[model samples]
Target: MLEMSNGSQHQTMKLSKNSWILILIFIILLLFFSILFFFRSKPEYVSKVDIALGTTVKVVVSSDKDPGLIIEAILREFHRIDRKFSVTDPKSVISQINKSENPVEVDEETAFVIERSIALARATEGAFDPALGNLITLWGFDRINDSAFKPTIPSDSQIEEALEKSGYENILLENDVVILNNSVKLDLGGIVKGYAIDRGLSIAKEMDPEATGYIDAGRDIGIIGPKFGGEYWAIAVQDPRGDSGEYIDLVYLKKGAIVTSGDYERFFMMDGVRYHHILNPKTGYPIRETISTTVISPDAMDADAFSTAAFVLGSEFSAVLLPVLGGQGLFVDAQNKATYTEGWSFFKEKH
Candidate 1:
């Protein structure tokens, strides 16, 4: 009887040990899945802001990991691209190409930008020309922020001479080589900011495919993925004739880009006349038909180019061009009447 009683107690002890082992395994599996779900279920958002490309650059990133590394990668790329394409920098590749008499070999980015600029110029029939560097210089916009900048309207002959050296046809690119006509210069100031924003957004996406983000490079903003679990981004349009903080419209977008070109952005007033930086290649003067133009497209670079082109072409032409480009636009005329394309109306909220 004593031996039997001892055997029964041993059996109970063994059973208890096996039960505890099973419970431990179950707890381990639960913790493992919980950790996995925490990372995979929802993403966290982090953002960074920096100044580059002569404008404010803001980036918002969503990821499970901290976004410091991603933001640094983006800003580094912006700085590199800015150095390669800046016309103001005498040592930049674009400046080198402009100064060289022979065909100049440039980086891939410069070549691509020049190619795209020329195509857009052709498409707009020279309404947006990047080869107007001479005209821009004659108008004193090239030396922006210069203390010696005396705002003087050039003589008719001077304007004509500057126009002589400016034409989209003067730029030729073969592979990585860019050849410009004599005395012709290239200024990418109008489009580089948008390109940089696109590049930054691409980098953020590469870092984390599931991440959502937006990069705003001054007047241009590039959005990747969706916001706050598939919500659209809100963009406000500046009122051209109103006070500084006044807005004319609001745009909601899930992805793609939005860019604006306005006389209010950069200009000098002399003798009660405004001389803006966006020069019409044909007229050698700022576009006056529209006070501001905004374009939304799948490509930020296209949006940037179109904004300037539409501003030059005015409301009638822009209304037509916007649809052809598979984009939408809002043009503000001198009368403060906002004209929206049919597609643009989709984004506009009803009053």
Candidate 2:
């Protein structure tokens, strides 16, 4: 009886040990699967950077699929527009138009750009003329960033000659054809950068409407959508005289575009004078009154053109004209005085 009882006890202890082993194995598997599921269900975001349109372009997106593919597609669009409107490329439409003596028939897109440019020039009272290609080339601003470029100052006669060729009236668009008179060389450098940003954003949205991103081309930013999903983007406007990355103000934007045109962006120090890329259509010289102009508009193109116009027209003039043109502006003059439009405070409000 004692031997039988001992055997039965030993069997019961073995079975109990096996049961605990099975339970521990099940717990380990449960934990492993839980961790795997947690990671698999999390959203993946990506960012990419490249050089396009003569600037550093960065695109960031949160996508359900491969984000790299979407970014490459958007970059391809930027290159396409850059190549199409390039002033230096002899094969580009702008170069062809500049070289031809007669009127050239352009695509509808080009015609629209020229027409809108003429209208902007008129509204700014020639402050933002698009027909200043000759002046731009004379100062070597067109190839200012080129490796082989040399800082050049045109003579008074040369400046006058270029100025004579600079006038928006010289350009006439008739039914998708452009007429360039007075030896006017066509250059759209002022607004093409912003247009490229807008194009990149459009491409990103088309590929994935629900995806959120922003395209930052040379610090002129266009929000593809809200940051992450519905967060506002904090954008800083750089101080024109301060060091690189030194900002003077902050603005919060959920959508739309912001552009800044500054004398410090492209300039050559000659005779202790800062001669920048932003030229005055009337004077045929670099604008001296305002050092920088920042514009926030619903459209990047408008912000681009208006910033240039306001930079040339000076701060007080832009204060009145910018609001009328459907944009809020911040202007810093050579004296370091800051000015703002009535609606400029709207950007500061993060609603």
Best by TM-score: 2
Per-residue lDDT of candidate 2, residues 1-351 (tens digit): 112347446432334677788889999999999989887765556778888777888888777766788889988888888888989889988998999998899998888888888888888898888899999999998898799999978999999999998899999999998999889887888888888887777877888887787888888888888877888989999988899989899999988899999998888998898899999898888988899999999888889999999999999889999999999999999898899999999898788
Off by over 4 Å in 1: 1-44, 146-148, 349-351
Best candidate, lDDT:
2
User: Model 1: clashing residue pairs?
Assistant: none
Off by over 4 Å in 2: 1-44
Residue-level lDDT of model 1, residues 1-351, one tens digit each, is 112347436432334676788889999999999989886754366777788776678777776555778878888988898888877889888889888999998877777889989988888888878898899988888776667878888899999999999998999989888889858899887778878888887887888776677887775788867777588877899898888768999988888899999998778998898889888888798878789999998888888888998998889888988789777999999888899888997776532
Clash count (model 2, backbone only):
0
TM-score per candidate: 0.84, 0.89
Give the alpha-carbon lDDT of every model: 0.83, 0.87
